[model samples]
Target: MSKSIELKKKAAEIRIRLMQMIHKAKAGHTGGSLSNTDILTVLYYHTMRHNPMEPKWNERDRFIASKGHSVESLWCILADLGYFPSSELDTFSQFGTRLIGHPNNKVDGIEMNTGALGHGLPISVGMALAAKRYDNDYRVFCLMGDGEQAEGSVWEAAMAGSHYKLDNLVGIIDRNGLQISGSTEDVMGLDPLDKKWEAFGWHVVSIDGNDIDALIETFDKVPSVEGKPTLIIANTVKGKGVSFAENAINWHHRVPSEEELALAVQELQAQIESLDSKEEPCHE
Candidate 1:
């Protein structure tokens, strides 16, 4: 299969797994997970150097899902990447299941158990610092929600990353605009977000988070500036790829009804077909 076709397939699978997990759990941050699916797909399937068989491989890259509420996306990607069996996704939120609302380090591929708004960036910074000190070439990637950027700890980590010149770390913000309550601007204005990161001495790039081409190119063009961490402010829609759910705050942590789930699955499948049609035909 062509690389584009493979990525499209991976994205479709990720979306299916995410919807299935959330529907079974009857509880999850569906909107945010959907919004960040493409980004996570690029990281796990295309960008990051990780080994499912040896998840604890010391030299492997680390990914921190800082906006832990949206962990269904991470769980889906982890399962797809062989961190765990796809069947385990059905156990999400069930009694004795390790697949809780937030990621847990005890989970095979999870580096840190993060659900709190601002914790992942700091933890990722620490990982990056450790890697640098040990002369390891591994990289650290952290994904934070735009709303989570309101947390003070995120800024603290930003300062530390810049001060230490931890170029090995990269932070991707899901700037999807909406939070649980309302739009992020109304909750807390992050206007001039790129400027803020730039002023913090980090390299900043902005892109359409849902665009596969942009995601692929951005990940390929990492280490934005040597000696400084790179932050990609990925502009996204809250409930991406689903018309009714898109930009709807109600889906933030709401369980989808059976009808809704069915429709969502159909829509996602259609999207996959559309992507397939757009791909250039492979020569025999």
Candidate 2:
């Protein structure tokens, strides 16, 4: 159908595939994977200038999944883009498989190893700063979790991004609220999140992260300020797209039971069909 509709369909397909991948393996950081899917979909399919065939091309943009536990979603995107064979998804999280729980540079599309939360932004900052030093135009993007924001290293990197004026770096916080333990606010409050980043000298924008159209528009208009890093506070529902899993903290790292998988499949199929009919708000 239309371009926007196509993006929605792509996201649905990725969600379906990633859930299956996790289900087959009987393990994954489920809630965060689903919550972060739409953002990864938009980045790989639309926003980022990356090549599956030449993942390491210097001119290509860089992306890091700092909240590395959610890598099932990223792997789905990379495989669909042909960075590697889709069959490899089946081996995810298995011993002797390259598709480990966390992303490592060994994977074709991965920019670096990242699973120790709160490191993505710092690494991305270094990449973006190096781009500036070399007078290159490549940009760097990092996706993180709200829980990871509690790390002091994140703030240190945030201050550095601002001080260095990394206009080419864009970081997105998957503000899904719920983390593995419980609600992020309950764990460690990050209220006034936007202002906190702004106080650190960032250009912050908040938006519905599940909406593909909103995601597209936001990414297109980033680096809105000159000489500043952009941090998108993406409001998202933990376990987005799965009826039973959505906002359920227990699903943070839980594997879906067969019944739960069937329900998720039914719900996502309905979503895909509805998009085909016209347009509807994606369930958050």
Q: In candidate 2, what are the lDDT values of residues 1-284, reduced to their tens digit?
A: 67778988888899999889999999899999999999998898898898888888999999999999999989998999899999999999888999999997899999899989888999999999999999999999999999999999999999999999999999999999997788899999999999999999999999999988899999998667999999999999999999888898899989888888888988999999998878554678
lDDT of each: 0.89, 0.92
When summed lDDT is taken over every stretch of 10 residues in candidate 1, the lowest stretch is 1-10
lDDT of 1 by residue, 1-284 (tens): 66756786777778777887888888899899989988998898899999999999999999999998899988888887788988888999899998899998888889988888899999999999999999999999999999999999999999999999999999999999999889999999999999999999999999999887799999998876899999999999888877888999998988888898899889889978877777758689
Count of clashing residue pairs in every prediction: 0, 0
Give the best candidate by lDDT: 2
Which residue pairs show backbone clashes in model 1?
A: none
Alpha-carbon lDDT of model 1: 0.89
**CA shift of 106, model 1, Å:** 1.1
> What TM-score does structure 2 among the candidates reach?
0.97
